[model samples]
Target: MKQRHEVFFKQLEGMRNYLLKVADVTEEEAQIVPKGFKNNIRWNLGHVFVEQYAWIENLTKEEVDFPKHFNEWFGWGTSPDDFTAETPSLEELKPLLKEQIANIKGTYGDRLEEVFEPTQGMDTLEQVLLWTTFHEGMHLQTILDIKKVYECLIEN
Candidate 1:
């Protein structure tokens, strides 16, 4: 079980790195989708980056000192429309994304072996690990979808 946790973190880290690399090629304005429901790649990316801290702190009962207003900006209770489409430049957000992945991989990777109080039907460490990846994977797909729309907008 511990070994599986280790493997999942590795895979999670790889997926996160891939998403960050994709952001490098995305245009800044293209990172904001106005007429659509989704919050563009930047917001989705930032949301996930922020979630590392949120989830870790929730599970580990430790202080993470995450960005202020992150909850308001990215919390599930708050819609993307709650804030303007303003987002940091790729240069800015890129490091944040990388830093977040580093923090999770370095600080919280092994910590997953500890028991997590069940929430939302996740009863074991494996379930929480898998659910986190599932959440991330959904946004990764959102990034790709937003990228396609961004390209179409530019070409048109």
Candidate 2:
């Protein structure tokens, strides 16, 4: 189990680096909804952080480390239209995503032996983190797609 956790930690480093690359967009670009997409780059970026925090904190029944009322803006079904307060800028979202990766690694790296029961077919913290890296990768791909569309918009 410890070795498995160690492997995922390295995988997470790749995720962290990919997310940072996805986040390199202007605030305006982040909010632009390309014609075929329902969400903007900004929304997807924040969603990644929201998911990591929600899965870990919810399962552990521990206090989440995100900003105040983050779920209101970034939860699974929440969207920019649902936001009642100011959301973080692209600049702000990037670092928060980066910080969450560090928090997860720092807090759990040595403790993967700690077991939590299966919820949604994930039987342990390591399983959740493992799945989350793939989840974040999907969103990073979405961000990249959005950027490609944004580029088309720019070229036009």
Candidate 3:
């Protein structure tokens, strides 16, 4: 992989690491839907995971491996209210989230510059990956906000 491409991957890994570290909440905490928030930490985490796969698949025009029911449980427009007992817990998602960066790097490291039919204004694999990083970063902030709200509620 080129140095520039590696930078994107590193940025992604760093953000993912920060997210996992910041989300040190218990499963119960992860599920808590703080007032004014439509989703919980668990939903944010799962959405990040599922969205990454969806973006990669769109760019590659091939199926990206992901856990089943991820779209239903965490895809765009999904809500925690829709989650069922079969929905994977935060524990189940952590490892998958950890593994996703490596999977993406290994699968697309050499194909970064490859152009595809434009999706979301991204015509290159590199562009899509960069977008995914930004998307994950946004959700990381949401997760942090959710955690803060719940923690404050507990303290009050």
List pairs with backbone clashes in candidate 3.
Answer: none
Per-residue lDDT of model 1, residues 1-156, tens digit only: 377766786787788788777666645553577566557666777677676566666665668866757667666655556665454545666787777655665666666656767566654444565676678888888777777776787899
Per-residue lDDT of 1-156 in model 3, one digit per residue for the tens? 789888888988998999999887899889888889999999999999999889888777899877757899999999999899999999999999998999988988899898888998999888887888888889989988887887787799
The TM-score obtained by model 3 is 0.96
* Higher-ranked by TM-score: 2 or 3: 3
Please rank every candidate by lDDT, starting with the best: 3, 2, 1
- The TM-score, computed over Cα atoms with residue i paired to residue i, of candidate 1 is 0.78
Q: For residues 63-156, could you state the per-residue lDDT of candidate 2 as single tens digits?
A: 7666757778877887768755488877888778777767887887776657776678876777788778789889888889989987987799
lDDT of each: 0.67, 0.79, 0.89
- TM of each candidate vs. truth: 0.78, 0.89, 0.96
Clashing pairs in 1: none
RMSD of each: 3.0, 1.9, 1.0
Candidate 3, which segments miss by more than 4 Å at Cα? Answer: none
